[model samples]
Target: MSRYAETYASWRADPVGFWQQAAEQIDWFTPAKSVFNPASGVYGRWFDGATCNTCYNCVDRHVVAGNGDRLAVVYDSPVTGQVARYTFGELQDQVSALASVLRGLGVTKGDRVVIYMPMVPEAIFAMLACARLGAIHSVVFGGFAPQELATRIDDAAPKVVISASCGIEPGRVIAYKPLLDEAIDLSENKPDHCVILQRDTQLCDLTPVRDVDYAEAVETALARGEGTECVPVDATDPLYILYTSGTTGQPKGVVRDNGGHMVALKWTMEHHYDIKPGEVFWAASDVGWVVGHSWICYGPLLHGAATVVFEGKPVGTPDAGTFWRVIQDHGVAALFAAPTALRAIKKEDPKGTLIGEYDFSKFRTLFLAGERSDPATIEWAQEKLDRPVIDHWWQTETGWAMSGNPVGLGAFPVKLGSTGKPMPGYDIRVLDDAGNAVAPGTLGNIVCKLPLPPAGFPTLWNAPDRFISSYMAEYPGYYATSDAGIIDEDGYVFIMARTDDIINVAGHRLSTGAMEEVIGSHPDIAECAVVGKADALKGQMPLGLFVTNNGANRDESELERELVQLIRAKIGAVAAFKHAIEVKRLPKTRSGKVLRGTVQKIADGESFKMPAAIDDPAILDEISAALKAHNMIGEPV
Candidate 1:
């Protein structure tokens, strides 16, 4: 039997005592006066009155404990054909020198530094260097449009911006310097200095007074023996601000504190991921995302494990076998990625032929997040790799998994459609429109009881009232997750869809995610998305868009009919799932989440802003054309 029940019960029994024990794992300069203070921030604060340095806990303490020679980071970029490794000691030297450079440029405690660069090792060094000086770092996605980047720059008001000349892709090079320059020009808040890393692949001209060469500055600091040490800071101090899109035009800046952030992420490395010191843990995500911040950079280093900084696509980085090659090249113990990635690989190599090309001696677990992992994709990965395909659920606000299988405590039996049970510290509840608890297997809003566990956001940057209105005001005492889900009698949580994705079809609420699951299971379909379309007769109807596998050739009309029949048979007649369309590909964000809302807007003939995070704007045209061809476009309001 899994020890998960006992561990969760222990946390629920003594919430403070549980987190206090977890906090002891980190090296703290000053112990906390209280494990929690319910009267602290917007909701509450964890580890109040403690003093700590996140960089030290993540880097220095390990070296001081005589594990300096252990591997700390492995940089593997298939796009550039580059591979580099760094030991804990070497990583410390690089971070210390960079910190000295930032200190010389007048970046002090509480100051914000903006990192706008590609997936180079220097980006990781820049983040750690800022932490070493007790400064907050905000890393924007490398190739964000100038307007989007300008919005973040105006909000964060960073003192120094560290960026690179360009970012290399499979068939092209994206010049980042021009984008960074345009964003600065567009924003009102101007950074004092801009440090640019000049890559040999493509270099750009830099402004004389404002721009500084990254290599020259760091080399000068290193040669002059001007390395800096970690600065002690309060546990409640903000470590970083990650911005997510908001309902309003402005983005919501999510603040993560230093103390609780370290304590919680460190605990997750050992427990949720089952990663140990000196082992390799790869989170195949960009540094701009929360997954990259939590796993690729801080989590593994804090746990004294090696992390892989991969800069390549799941496919087309030479071929579909790239991910397997990286895992085999480095002895990866656990791999975390989004479901979109696996689907992309499965689309190109439908038979799992590429998976057999690599050795799996050191590989163990495969974790999926960022989006709902359809049962079809999960079963394919499990059967091919012969390993546990675990799907955990969380959001950017939480900064860690709220519900997952704790591999260290002993993983529970796999449930294909469920995202496992709630992990320790999360008191999950399914509530109805009346704010009352729902019965087992009943679909309703998912929420967690107040005083959310550590690592969760304390408050939004400069917007405490918005934080309350956005998340807490909905349920009075509980934090609203804004997701529609159900907890079965067996206590397995099934995340059906986002609350907005639930539609009323002649008074019956139906989940688009459920429809997608059934449609995705068809052998000819590689991936699919379902959205509720406006209907005059029925309030709304379910519309499906899907892409076929590599060699699957069937009449589009026949495939559409088959998919509609499949959904009707599985979900009953209330679904109103008659329409289906085959597309070249579905539009997605850079992080692999389908842009369903955008597709819905197109189907309704409504004007929508071009999504800033969309991977390709051209895909929207294709979707619009398909809708027009099918006469599915709704009358514009």
Candidate 2:
């Protein structure tokens, strides 16, 4: 039997004691006066009055423990046909040298540094360097539009901006220097210096006095033997400020503390992922995302596990088998990726033939997050890889998994439709509009009890008021997850959809995610998205858009008819799922989340801002054309 029940009960019994025990794994300069201070900032603070250095815990401590030769990072870039590896010792040298350079540039404790670069080892070094100096780092996704980057720059007011000349895509090179320059020009807050890493794929001109060559600066620092040591900081000090899109036009900076973040992420590396020291843990996500921050950079390093910095797409990075090749080559133990990636690979290689090309003997569990994992994708991955396809739920606010099957605790039974049970420290509850408990298996708002566990954001950077209003205002003593889900009698949590994705269909509430799951299960369909469109009589109706699998040639009309029938049979006629359109592809964010809200706005003939994280602006036009061809666009209300 799994130890999940006993472990969870232990945490529930003494949340502070549980986290305090986990804290012993990290190397702290000063032990906390109190494991938790209920009178601390916002909801509360963990490890109050402690002192720690995140960079030292992640890098230096490993060397001091005689594990310097152990692999730390594996940089695999299929797009560039390059591979590089670093040990704990090499990582320490790199991070310290860069920290010295930043210190020379006047970046001190409490200052903010903005990192805007591609998936290169330098980006990781930049983040660690900032932490070494007790400075906060904010990583903006490379190639973000100038306006979006400018907004982040204004909000962060960074003292220095570290970026690259360009980022390489499947068939093209995106020049990032021009975008960074334009963003700096557009923003009111200007950094004192800009460090640019010039990639061989593309070169850029740098402005004198403002732009600094990354290699030259690092080489000088190394040659002079001016490596900087880690600076001790309060446990409550901010480690990084990650900006997520806000409901308002501005971006909300999610603040992560040094102490709680290290303890929590280190615990997850062993418990949630079942990864051990020296094992290879690959989180196939960009550094700009929370997954990259926690898993790819910090979590694995803190646990002494090797992390993979992959710079390629799930497909078209040569072919659909790239992921398997990397896993086999690196001896990856656990791999975490978004569901959209699996869908893309499955669409290109429908028969799972590419997976057989590589021997992934070391690969263990496959974790899926970022977006809801439809049962179809999970089943396909499980069948092809013959491994557990664990779908966990988390957000940018929470640096680690909220609900997941604890593989190290012997893993609970796999429930295809549910995102497992709540992990330790998360007291999940389903509540109605009045904040009352809802019946089992009934859809309602999902929330967690007050005083969220460690690694969760304490407050929005410079905006505690906004944090309260955005997340806690509506649910009174609870931290509203803003997700609509159900809990079965067995205690499995089924996250059906975002609260906004729930539709009122003829006075009945229906989940678009449920409809998408059924439609995606059809053999011909590779992936699908369901959105609730405006309907005059029924308040709202479900609209389905899907892409077909490779080599699947069926009449569009027949496929549409089949999809409609499938939904009706599965969800009954209450779904009103009449409109099903086959498209070349669905619009998605760079992180691979479907832009359903944007699609809904377009279908309703309502104007919507261009999403900052959208993968391709052109995909919106394609979606619009498809809606127009099918006469699905409704008049603007």
Candidate 3:
């Protein structure tokens, strides 16, 4: 039975009384009598006026309970096979020392600090250190090129920048000092100083005017006894700026508040993961993204759980088995990574030498996010890794794990392609375009009606108007997730795809993601992208483009006919493809996101606009070739 199953039974029976009890978990400056505002459609407010420092909630509170000596962080160094563990007490001290260094460089409350580093232990240290002194951190994803790096630096102007030697990325190690050197030469507002974390663990070779070694700086500051005074922060104070790849095709700075983010993530860790202190845990996404921030750094710390902030990709380095090795080599209790990582693993022969050696006895919970997990991948992982891949669904806007197949308490009968039932102390609904609840099994946008739980929110940093216009204006009076999903009879959520990812073929609506998955599942088709192409009679038709797993040259007519048949088999005649173009590769962003709109632009007989951020522009040619071969010839895939 789920820990909250009885409460869920009662809550489902009478929601009004259920939240009245749920609201008692936190410290509230002003008491909220109710959890819902039926009239406004907003339903969350916990401990109104409550003020708590996020880092404090993460570390100090745990220390006060005498678990200070317990593990707070586990560092699985790819360079060294050793697992570095830091107790809550030692982690707090390091965070304080780093916070002092940040303060010494003149970063104060409300000042922004841009952190571009690999998912190393220092990345978490820098983030919490900034939080300790009330400095908002804007972390750019580590995989970005120099130009995209500059854009983020421009967006979040910081007094001091923290960067690491990018030894972990593909090909050349992206020396941060060089990029910092170039970005500084270009920017009018260059960082006052640059603190370099030697990922190469080597001293800086390039010259930047005010460059300082990160480790030595912290050590020097600690010796001086001039540590940071952990400032008292307000609930509404800006905590950190996490950038999200919004539909606008540019990274939107999602400015999250300290208290609100803390409350939400902490609640999620406690209630969803059922996490306990001293347990070793790892959230596989890098600290550069929200997953790294909420789950890996702040949330775990806030809740007093030990966390692993790894620096390397699972597939890179000596072998793909690195992640499995880390899990068994270290007793990782809970592990979280994106389904993107898993899909890549799935594409690799499942019988690869990597899956057989690990001991999974220590793993209790595993989370898959970034994108929805294909159910096949979930079952395969369950059998291979010897644990359930709790296929989770959430976005950058939701803070942390909003919907998850809860492992410890709320395990339900696993539904193929379904994220679990709603979490404790929260309510979720699937709403139509009209904002009314949709019938169960009928697809609708996911909506979290207001009075939003402490962490549940709708905002784009400081831009309230943008938040209102984007989330609110879409469906009117509801926070539209923009993603298509359905609520099963058991209240489990099955996210289909992004809502706009639909196509009309002979007046029949079809989802490109579902259809693309069908194409990708084909034996020779290793990866695929399907999009709607404008047509006269049909209005729109499905056009597919793909990269073959075996990279075999095939008869164009034969391959095209085979794909059409595959779609017909999976989705019926109504959703069969108009044409398919087999390509060597599809255009993808650096983060492995397919540039779907770019493909649509090509299909529309228009010139595609490239985001200046993409690291490789050559891949666009392959899309063009596939499209041309399939007679999608106006432009590209």
Candidate 4:
């Protein structure tokens, strides 16, 4: 047996002890006396009694260990055609200077500081600066609507807002300062100050009384010759508050603590990603999302690795070869991206010509997350790259991968469609409505047995009752994931779909994810999403919307028939998957999760509002037209 197997078994036997040992790896200002405290009536706390500064662990310690000269971050932007690298020492100094600036702005420990910047080095600097001062940083994804930004501002009520003047997109520049100004104008609770990075002075507005230039702040701090001290914070102090889309249409702020998050991410960087210190790690995600928070910014830094901050898409910024070019140029050992990204790249280059043009000898592994990974996308990628394309499952609530193939530990057996076994700290189960564990091969709700592992969201920011009712109340002693999946006899877990995403045909429940997986596997199809439409006799039926590969020559009607037949053959007739339509593109969020619910609502002619996180708002019109043309639903008069 592999040593990873031993480690898993030992962790299963003693989870608390395993995590306690893991926590010892970090240099804490004051060591923790207790590993976990759960009986506090609220959410459980981890690493209790510890005092540490997160910035010190991520930046200062690496510099002190003689790795200061090693590159800590590489900022690559295809939009601007610029490449910049920062060493550990340089990053620490920048973070320190910014920390001093925040202190000068009256930001003290526990104060909320909102970051509204693009995918730039300054964003990381702002995050670390907040950590250095023990202030909670809430980073909103750049380019969100003014109302959405205002809502976040009203919630966090930060004393300072840090942002750039503009953001660089594929063929355009987004003026972020205007949006920030408009948001603050619309907000009921205005921030006391605004710090703007003047990426474009021509497009920016400075409020003399309330705003300060980032360059001027840094220069002043440097001139003062003051070393900003890293304030020691309690182990359970809130590090950041990230808002994720909630079921009720209100965004819920997920809070991550300092010590537990640091410990868990460091462990994941080594155990899950299999990259050690000094190796390059690239997570192709935006900083607004949890993946970006955990992997892109903090995780790699905590593990002493160089993280690449990419400001480009998987395709069309330069071309379909963007990811390949980055991998080859940066020597990225492990790459994490959404499945939607791979699907888009595969659609544009079905023959993998783009991949063939690059030399990826340094690339070791490929991981997929954020959204569900279809077996077709995973197989094509793994075969094309000649490496393992691992698919893992976790949530924004959980900071890291809860179930994933540990590539560094050993070559675990690959189950193509399965996300892999639960990680060492997670005890996952598929439970029925009554909270009983379901038998193997039976679909049920996915839940994690309490107390949740370290690095997990302890509670919603300022809303402990919402946290309990949202996650814990559904299952008395478990964290209800609200996702539906099944566990195989061999313990491999397969996430079928979200619980609410299940389609009911007559009395049989069908998984849209399962149908999409089979449809997407068809050689002609590049990607697909399935939603349920109302049927006269069956009550509801599966409707698959798909994008074809570039070289597919079949007509839309013929391709639709072929996809329907393929689903019928693979998933059986009980799925009632009759309709498949060829669409130009499926609507997706900025993070690349397909908007299946929006598609379903349109098909059913139900009232539904488009989520604010949608990347392309006009895509909804295309979907509505597709539905009407196919007679799946009639056009609104």
Instruction: Give the number of the best model, judged by lDDT.
Output: 2
* Candidate 1 segments whose C-alpha is farther than 4 A from its true place: 246-248, 635-637
Model 2, range 1-637, lDDT digits (tens) per residue?
Answer: 7999999999999899899999999899999998999899878899999999999999999999999999999999998889999999999999999999899889999999999999999999999999999999999999999999999999989999999999999998999999999999999999999999999999999999999999999989889988998999999999999998532388899999999999999999999999999999999999999998999999999999999999999999999999999999999999999999999999999899999999888999999999989998999999999999999999899899889999999988999989999999899999998899999999999999889899989999989999999899999878899899999999999999999999899999999999999999999999999998898888888889999999999899999999999999999998888889989989998999898999999998888999999888999999999999999898521
TM-score of model 3 vs. true structure: 0.88
What lDDT tens digits, residue by residue, belong to model 1 across residues 1-637? 7899999999989999999999989999999998899889877899999999999998999999999999999999998899999999989999999999888888999999999989999999999999999999999989989999999999999999999999988898999999999999999999999999999999989998999999999999888988998999999999999988532388899999999999999999999999989999999999999998999889999999999999999999989999999999999999999999999999999899999999889999999999989999999999999999999999989999989888988899989889999988899999998899999999999999988888899988888898999899999999999999999999899999999999889999888999999999999999999998888888888889999999999899999999989988999988988889999999998899999999999998888998888888999999999989999898421
Check candidate 1 and list the clashing pairs.
Answer: none
* Per-prediction backbone clash count: 0, 0, 11, 0
Poorest 10 consecutive residues by lDDT, candidate 1: 243-252
Q: Which runs in model 3 stand beyond 4 Å of their true positions?
A: 3-5, 8-46, 79-83, 143-147, 165-167, 184-190, 201-209, 246-250, 434-437, 520-527, 547-563, 581-592, 603-605, 609-618, 635-637
Q: Which 10 consecutive positions of candidate 3 have the poorest summed lDDT?
A: 40-49
Task: Report lDDT (Cα) of residue 124, candidate 2.
Answer: 96
lDDT of 4 at 612: 75
Write candidate 3's Cα lDDT for 53-169 as tens digits. 667767766777898898888887665444577888887888888898888789898899988877677888888888888888988766555666676677778898888755455
TM-score per candidate:
0.99, 0.99, 0.88, 0.98
What number of backbone clashes does candidate 4 have, counting pairs of residues 3 or more apart or in separate chains?
A: 0
| True-vs-predicted CA distance for residue 295, candidate 3, Å | 1.7
| Better model by lDDT: candidate 2 vs candidate 3 | 2
